[model samples]
Target: MVWRALRPAFALWIWLAIGLAPLAAQPATEDTEDLLQKAMKAAVARVAPSVVQIETSGGSDILGSGPGMFRKGAGPTTGLVVAADGYVISSAFNFANKPSAIFIAVPGHKERHVAKVVSTDNTRMLTLLKIDAKGLPVPVAAPKKEFRVGQWSMALGRAWAGLDTPPSVTAGIVSALGRIWGKAIQTDAKVSPLNYGGPLVDLQGRVMGVLVPASPRGQDETAGVEWYDSGIGFAIPLEDINAVLPRLKEGQDLKKGLLGIYLKSTDIYSVAPEIASVGIDSAAAKAGIKAGDIIIELNGQAIVRQAQILHILGEKYEGDTVTVKVQRGKEELTFANVRLTGTLSAFIHAYFGVLPVRDDPELGEEIRYVFPKSPAEASGLKPGDRIMKVGLAGSPMQPFSGRDELTQLLDALQPGTELTLEIMRKGAKKPETVKVRLGVMSDEVPEDSLPEPATLKKALAPRKVAPRQGPPIQPGQPGPRPGRPQPGAPRAEEKKEQPKDEKKKAATGLLKRMTPARDHEYWLFVPEDYDPNIAHALLIWLHPAGKNKDKDTEAVLAAWEDLCSENHVIILCPRAESNAGWLGSEVDFVQQVARDVLAEYTIDRQRVIAHGLGIGGQMAYYLAFNARDLVRGAAPIGAALSNQPKDNAANQRLSFFIITGAKDPLAPAIQEGKAKLAEHKFPVVYRELAGSPQYLDAGTLQEMVRWLDSLDRQ
Candidate 1:
C-alpha cells in the first residue's frame, strides 16, 4: 500500500474508504451472506452474556468525580471471569503493584462486585482474580490451531465505560497468528480498552485468545495500552491458559526447563536440522554434548530439528526424567534415561524473585553443550552426539537423564572441574562413558567483547557486515578447507592503499566500531572521496520496522550518504537487531554504538546525527528524545514524533527535524508529533516532503542532509 500522511480532512476520506472496503469486497453468493450473518448472530448470543463487563478502580477517591481521580479505588483495569465462582483472569499490567481491589460486572448484572487478585504471572501477562460470585459459566476455549486466516472473531466489551452500550461488539478476524505472545496466546482481535479483559470468541463461541494491549502499548505511546481494536488487538491463547492454569490455580510456581543452550534453526522455514553454536557447560556439555551436534531425537521421540527439541525440553520440569535418542552418522544411540534439572532460572526465582524469562529464538535451542575431551577423543565424543546421562553426578546414582540434573551438578562444581560423563557417542560399539574436566571452550566468549580499546589497534579487525551465512556441509561430507587460511593471503586493494601507520589507525578506528552480535543490520557507505589513510565520520542510520531490516537500512543510508557526500559525510547504516523488523534492542544498540564512537573518534560531536525513514524516522525521534544530550539533531523522514510517555528516559533530550512524505501513513502521527514537540517546547525543524510518494525515494536524502547540515550545537 502506497501511503502518505494526509491532513485531518484527507484522513476522513481515507477512513471512509477503509470503512467501505469490506462492503465493496462482499461475496457474490447469497449463501455467504446467510452463513456469515447467522454465524455472527449465533456466536454473539452464545458468548456475549458470558463476556463480563470489566471495570477497574484504584486509589482513594476525591470528594467529587474528576479526571485522573480514583472514583472508587485502585486496581487492575479489568478482568473476565473464565471460570465459575468468580475465577477471573486479567492483564498482569493492569494488576501490577498490588491493586487495591478490582471490579467485575457481568452482563445483565447491575451491581459490580469487588474481587481480589489471586496471583500474577508476568511471563504469561495474566493475573488470576477471585471474586465472591457464583455460577459464572467459564467460556469454552477455542482451538488455537484451528483459528484460520481471515476467520471471523468478535471483541466484546463495555467500551468507553459502557457509554457505548450493553457490551459493544466490534468484528475483525484472525488477521494473523503465531505472534510472539510471550508465553501467552497472541491473536489479532478487534479489542480496545473496553475489551481489555474480554474474551475473543470464534464462530463456535469459544475463547481463542484473550484481549490485551497490542504493540506500542506503553501509555506514553497511547491511552489504554494503545488500540485493542483497529485490527491491532492481541489475545492470550486458550492453549497457553491451559498450561498456565494448572500452575496458577494450584499456586505452584512455574519454572521452565533450562538447557542453557543457544540454537538457531537450520530449518530456515522447513524441517531442516538445527545448528548448535553456543552451549553452556553447566548442562548438556557436562552430560557430554558439544557444539555442531545435529540433535535428531528426544526421549525416543523422532525430533526433526531444534525447535522440536526446544518444545520437548520446555515441557519437562526440574526433576523430570526422559530418554533421548540421537543419530551419530550410520549408527543411532539412546540415552536410556536423563533427569531434567534447573539452571539460571532456578536461581533467579529464589534470589531476584523475578518472573520467568520469556523465550527467545536463540535461547530456545541448545547453543551450548558438554563433552568429555579425553574420553570423547578416545572413545569419540563426536559433535553430533547427544548426552543421555551422567550417572555419577548424583548420589544413590539418581539418574542423570538429561541436561537439567547434569547442569545442576556442573553448577555445583568450580570452574575447570572434572566429572564422569556417560555419553552415547556416534558409531560407537558400546556406550563409551568416561571422565573429563570441564574446560573452557572458545565460543563461549562474547563476540562483541573483542580486544580491549588499546591492544585492538594492532589486530586486523574486519568490520562485521550483516549478511546470511552459507549452508552447513551435508551429513557425511567433509567441510571445504575446514579453518586453514592459505599462506600469503592477498590483501584487498583498499588495504594496500594505506601506509603502516594509517593501517594501524584504520584498525584502531575499526576497534571503536562494534556492532551487536546477533542480527546486526545496517548500511555501510564508503565515502566518494574516502581515503584509506584517513578515517571518515560513520553516521549510523537506524530505521523503524516496516520490511526487512538489512534492506531498509541499506536503502535509507545509501540515500543519506549520497546526499551527505555532496557535503562530505561518511555514513554507516546499522540495521536493527530484528531481521523481521525494528525491536527495542535494536534501538539500544544504535545508541550504544553512538556512545562508543564518541569515546574513540575525534569527529564533531555536534555533527553526530541519527536519522530514519519511516519507523526509522520514529526511532530517530525516539533517540533524540532518549539521548538528546548525545544527539545534535534528528531527521525523521517518513516517521513523526512518538506519543509515548515523556517520562520516558529518551524524551528528555528529544530534538528533531521532523520529515513527512506527502503520502506517508503516519502523516497524522508526524503532525501530532510536531504538535507534541511544540507542546513540550522542544526545538524542532519540520520538513514536509512535498509530492514524495514513499519513504525510500529521493526526498529522503534531501531531507536528511538538509536537516543534519542545519544543526549548530552552540
Candidate 2:
C-alpha cells in the first residue's frame, strides 16, 4: 500500500516542479518612489511662490447687536494667487459677513497689504480676492471641462499644524476626480483646517485644485500617536475657477443658463425621462416641456447617463442656444434653438464688481419678469419666451443653448453692441425673432440690496391661493355656511341661511372669486378670541433638535397651549425641512415665513421673539447674530453656537436665555461664551440642568417654557 501511494505522489510532485521552475524566473520592475518625489518637489517649487498667506481680522460678537466692528490680522489661511497682479482665490467659509480687513502675505516679502474681496461664488464655495501687488506670477489656467483620475498633484499653503509655527507645505497625489459643486478634489495630501483656501498644484507648476477639508485623524500623531493621513483632501477644480475668473476679474456680471425643468433618472436604457416637475413657470415649462417627457439627446448627441446633464448645462453661458430632443410616449419630437437664460449669479457677480451669471434653480422661465433693463429686455424679449439664436456683431448667428456656452457668451460680450434674438413662446405657431442692443452693465446688484422690502415682498408673493380644505364646521368656529359658499371657495353645496341680498349677489358673481389676493397667507395657530384689529405679539419658536417630527409637534403644541393660554401670543412653529433640520434652508425659509406672517397678520415687530431648543437653539443663535434687525430677543437651550465669529453690535442687541446641562462638556464653552458676550453688553440669563443635558424633558420643561414666556411679558 505504501509503494502504491508513493507512485501517485511522485507523479504529482513532478508536475508541480515544472510549474514552480518557470514562475521563479520572473523579473521585478524598478522602484518609482524617487520619480514621484522629484515630480512633487518640482510642482511645489513652481507653485509655492504663487501661494499667499491670508490673514482675516473678523469681528467677534458678544450678544445680538447690529453689525459688529471689525479688527484685522493674519492667522493661517491659504490662497492661490491666480493673476499676475496678485489676485488670490480662497474659500468663502473663511470670510463670513463683511469684515474690515483681509490681507495676503506676499512670498519672500515681510509686507502685507490689504486685499479686496473681488467676488464670492457661494454655490462653488470659493471667493476671489485682489491685492494691489504687481508682477506676481499667476499659475497656468486649466481648461474647465476635464480632469482625469490618478493625476499627480501637490498642495502648498501656510498650514497651521500647531500653535508653535506658521503655515507650511504638504504633498500627496490626486486620489480621485469628478467631484460635485461644493465638493473638492480628493487628494492624498495632508490638509489641515489651517490649509483652508490653499491651492493644489500639479507637476507643470499649475493649480490643479484648492485645499479644503481633509481627514481629521492625523492631528494626534504630533504627540507620537499613530494616526494616519486620510488621503482625502478636496480642491476646487481649476476648471470651474477658470470658467468664472474672467467675469470675476472684469467686474462684469455673469449670467448662468437656466433650464426650466427638474429631472430624475429612470431605468429606461435608451433615454432619460423627467420623473416630476418642481414648478410651473420654470424654464422647462416655457419650452413647452412637461413632466414625464423622455429626453433622448442634447445638441444632436445622444445622452446615455443622467449625470452628464447638469455638467453639460451648468457650463453654458447666458444667451447661448441649445437643441434638445425628447420622446413623449411613443412620439418622437425635438426642440431646437433654445436660448439660455441668465439667473441670480449674474446679479450677485455684478455686485462684487465681478460680472458672472449665477445659476439659480429658483429662476425658471419667469426670469424675464426680473431682468434689469438689459439688452435682452430692450430687444423686446418677454418672460416665458424661449430664445433660439443669438447673432453677434461680426460673427455668424450661433445656436445659444447649454449653460457653458451661455455663460461664456455673457462673459465675452462688449458693453455696447447690437444682437439679434430668436425666440419662441408657448401658444405661438412660429418663432418670433427680434433684435436687442446689449448694454455696458447687466442689471446686477449687491448683497446689501437683497433685503429691500419691495424685493422681499415680491419674492414672497404667493403664486396661488385658494380656500383650504378642512374638517366639518363646529358650533362657534367659522366653517362653510350651511347655505352659502365661503369666499375663494367653489359652490359645491347650497345654503339655507343665505340672506336674500347675499343670495342675489352670489347668483350674479358667485362663479368668480375676487382676484386671488396678491398673497396667500396661512397662520399656523391663532389664539382663542383673537381679533384682526388688535395687534398681537408673535413668537416664532424654532423646534428643538428632535421636535421636527409629528410626535415632536404634539409635545411642543401641548407645552405651547399652556403658555399661549395666559400670554395670548400668536405662536408660529414653522415646519423645518427634515433633511436640513435647522441648518439647511431653515434661515431663508424662516425669514420668508416671518415676512409672510407679518404681511398677512398684524404682528408687533418690536415684540417678536425667537426661541429654540438644541437645533432650534442653534438657529436662534444664527438669526440673532445674522438678522438682528429682524428679531427682538432669543432663547436657546442645549444648543451650540456656530464657530464662525459674530459682530459685536449684533451680539449686543441680542438678549440670551441660555439653558444647558451641568455635566455638558459644552457648558464650559458656554461659560467662556458668556464672558465673551459680556464684553459686548449683551444681557444673558443662564440655567444649568443637573443631569443629562440633551433636551427639555418633563423635569425641565416648565423652566424652559417660563423663561421664553418672560421675554415677551417683560
Candidate 3:
C-alpha cells in the first residue's frame, strides 16, 4: 500500500516538472499542455454541481444614483450550495438592491425553486439564502493554511442559462493571502459580477474561496466593484465561511463589532494605539476604559500599532467578548470578557461658543469671538476674556493650558453637562468663577457679519504689489475676457525683472500648471503674505464638468482672494483628466495632491475640507465618505449625494455643509440627501438660496468661508 501511494506522488512530480520547465532548458511536448487543460477541466467538473444560477427582478437601488455610480447588470448571477439541506451562500452585493423575488436553479433539477434570504454577514459582505430542497451537493473546502501563492486556481460560475449548460471557468494563480484586514484572499483570475458569488477551486477540485469584491477604504457592499476585471480580485476564504455557517443558519445578521474609541493619529502603521476619546455607553466605556489609555494587548495578542487591533477586531462579530489590556498612565490594567456591541450612541458635539485666539502663548486661552446667544454669552463671557481654569461641577479645577486641552476635554463630555470656568478679564486683577451648561452645536450659519479672528502680535513687512495685466473683472461674475487664453490652450510665459532690494519669498498668488505627476496638473492660490509660522486651513476645490478651464480658476481666485487672506486658508484646485466629467478612478489623484500639500505646508489637520460644485460635489461626497481619515468636512454646492452615508463612528468624525438653490432642479434630492445624513446623526449645515443659480453667489460664498473658519469649534 505504501509503494502504491509513493508511485502516484512520484508520477505527479514528473508531470509538474514537465509542465513548468522553461523553453531554454527544455521545451515541453503537446502532452504537457493537454494534461494541464484536462486537469483544469476536471477541477471545474468537480465543483460545478455545487454551483447554482441566481436570478432576481424588481429591486430598488441601494446605492444612490449619480455620475460614476455602480449599476447592477440584468443577467443571472451565481451562488454556492453550503449545505445538503438547501442552504446557499453568495455575496451581499448580489442582493444589495433587495429584489422582490429570488429564484435559484439547482443542478439536476428541471424547475427553479423560490428562495429567501436567511441572514447576512455585513462584516464580510456575504449573504446566506435558503430554498425548500433536500440532498444538495456541497463542495469540499480546501484548508486555508495549505494555500500558497503561485498555486493553480480556477474560478467557476453558473451565470449561463439552462441547467444542462456547464459552468464557465477561468484559470489563474493565487496572488496573495490575508488581504483586506485578513478577511479576503487575492487572486489574478477574472472575477466580476458574473463570477462574484461563485467558487474558486484548486487543482485538486477543492473550493478555496468564494469570489467577492472588497476594499479597505470603504465598507459598502459595492465598494470595490469598480475594480472588477482589472487584474485585481478578492475572495473570502471558504474555511472562514464554513466556520460561521452555523451562526448564519440561525438567522442572525452579523455586524462588525465596535469598541467606540478614536485614536490620536490616523497613521496606523507608525502611531501607537493611544485613545483620544471614548464614546458614551460604548463597550470601552462600559468596561471602564477612559481616554489616554494605550492599548497593549488584545485577546492575548500583543498590540503595538492601531492596525493590529483593527485586524483582530475585523473578524469579530457583534456580541463577541474580547479581553483587553491597556496602560493607563503608569499602571497596566486588564479588562476581562468585554462584550462588543454593534452600534454606539451618536456623538453630538458640545458647544462652548467661543473662538480662541490663534497661536496665543499666554498662560490662559484668550477668547477671540463670542456668539450672540451662546453658552459663553449667557455666562457673561466677552471678547478678550482669558479662561484660567475649568472643571466639572463640584470637582477640582484643572489649569487650562492651551486650546487643544480644552477641546479634548469638551469632546469627551455630553451636551447637558454643567461646567465651571475661572476667567480673568483684560483689566481685572483677580479671576472670577462662572458656571454654565453646555449646549448642542448649531447647524445654521451666523446671521450677522462676524468679527475677524485675533492672532498673536507680530511685526511683519509691507505687502508687495504686482501690476495688473488685464481688465478688471467683477467678483463672482468672471466672464470670458479679452486677450485671455481660452480653455485647454497653452498660455504664453512672461518673464519680469525684479528689484535689486526685493527679498526672495516662496511662490504665492495664482501658481499655475503644477504637475505633481504625469497627466495630472492643478492650480494653487497662496495668500500674498503666506507665513509658515502660522498654521493655515487647506481647501480643495472640485469644479463642475467642462468648467475646469483657466477662466474657472480666475473666477475662483477673484471671488475668494479676500476670503483666503482673511481666513488664512490655502486653496487647491485639481483638474479632471477630461471635460466629460470626473471619474471614480481620479479619487486617488485628488487625495495624493492634498497629501503633498499637507507635507509641504503647515496645514491644520482638523480643518482640512473638500468643497465642490455640481458634478464635482459628488466626488467630494465620495472622497469624504471613503477617505474618512483625511477629510474632516465636506462642502457640496448644487450637488446631491452619490452613495449611501455610513453610520457615524467615534474614530472617524465627519461633518457636512450642503448648499442648493430653492428653485433648482436638484433641490429636492439635496434635501433628501440632507435628511439621510441627519438620520445617521451626522452634523449637517444646509443652506437654500433665494433663487435658482448654478453656483454660489458672493454672499453665500462668504457664509461658507465663515463655516470653514469655525470647523475647529469645540
Please tell me which predicted candidate would have the highest lDDT against the true structure: 3
Which digits, one per residue and each the tens of the lDDT, describe model 1 over residues 1-714?
001111111111111101212332232344554455466567656765666655555543431111111232232244566677778777664543344656777666668877776765443456777778888877788876677766666766544434223345566556676543232334444455545666777767787867765442232212235243344677767667766776677665444444544333223235434333223443554554433344677776677655566556644555566665554444555655565545431111000000111111111111122222323344434443434434233311122212222232332233244445454455666754555544321111111211111011211233222121232122221112222221111123322334456634432211113365644544345445543322223465665465544454455554555555454455656655554445443556777666555443333333567766655666665566555446646766776554432421111123466667766666776787777665544456666766654564454445445444323210
RMSD of each: 18.0, 21.1, 11.1
Per-model CA lDDT versus the true structure: 0.46, 0.50, 0.76
Model 2: per-residue lDDT, tens digit, 1-714? Answer: 222322222211111101111212112211333343445556556666777777766644222211111222236667877778768888664565456788777777668879888776544556789988888877775543445555555566664432123235555556676554223467666654456677777656677777654221111101101112344567777766776898888764345466654443222243344423322343555676654455678777777655556546655656668887877656767878877665411111000012111111121112223244555655666545655555554433444322222332332233354655556775688977676655543212222221111111121121222122242111111212233211111112211223446433212100111113423222255556543333345677787644566566556666667456454456667666553356433465676777655655545443467777766777777677655546656767766654433333211124566778887766777676666655444556667888755556664555544433333210
> What's the residue-level lDDT of 689 in candidate 1?
67
TM-score of each: 0.47, 0.43, 0.86
Positional deviation of residue 392's Cα in model 2 after best superposition, in angstroms: 43
Candidate 3 TM-score, true structure as reference: 0.86
Ranking by TM-score: 3, 1, 2
Off by over 4 Å in 3: 1-34, 61-63, 66-68, 361-363, 457-504, 649-653
Encode model 3's per-residue lDDT on 1-714: one tens digit a residue.
222222222222121111233222114445555566567667777888899999998897545544456678888999999999999999998998889999999989989999999999998899999999999999999999999887777777777645676687766678898888888888877788887899988978999999888888778678788788787888899999999999999999999899878766566897678776677898998998877678999999999999999888888889999999998756798999999999877777777788777544344578877877898899999988988777777665556435554665565566888888889999999999998788886565666666655456211211112222232111111112234322111112211223456585457888876564478888888899877545578899998889878997788778889888887889989999889668777888888888777765556566789888888889889888867777878999888986668766544567899999888898999999999999777789998997877678888888887777776665
lDDT of 3 at 99: 93
Runs with alpha carbons beyond 4 Å of true place in candidate 1:
1-35, 57-78, 144-146, 161-166, 175-188, 192-194, 213-233, 264-292, 298-714
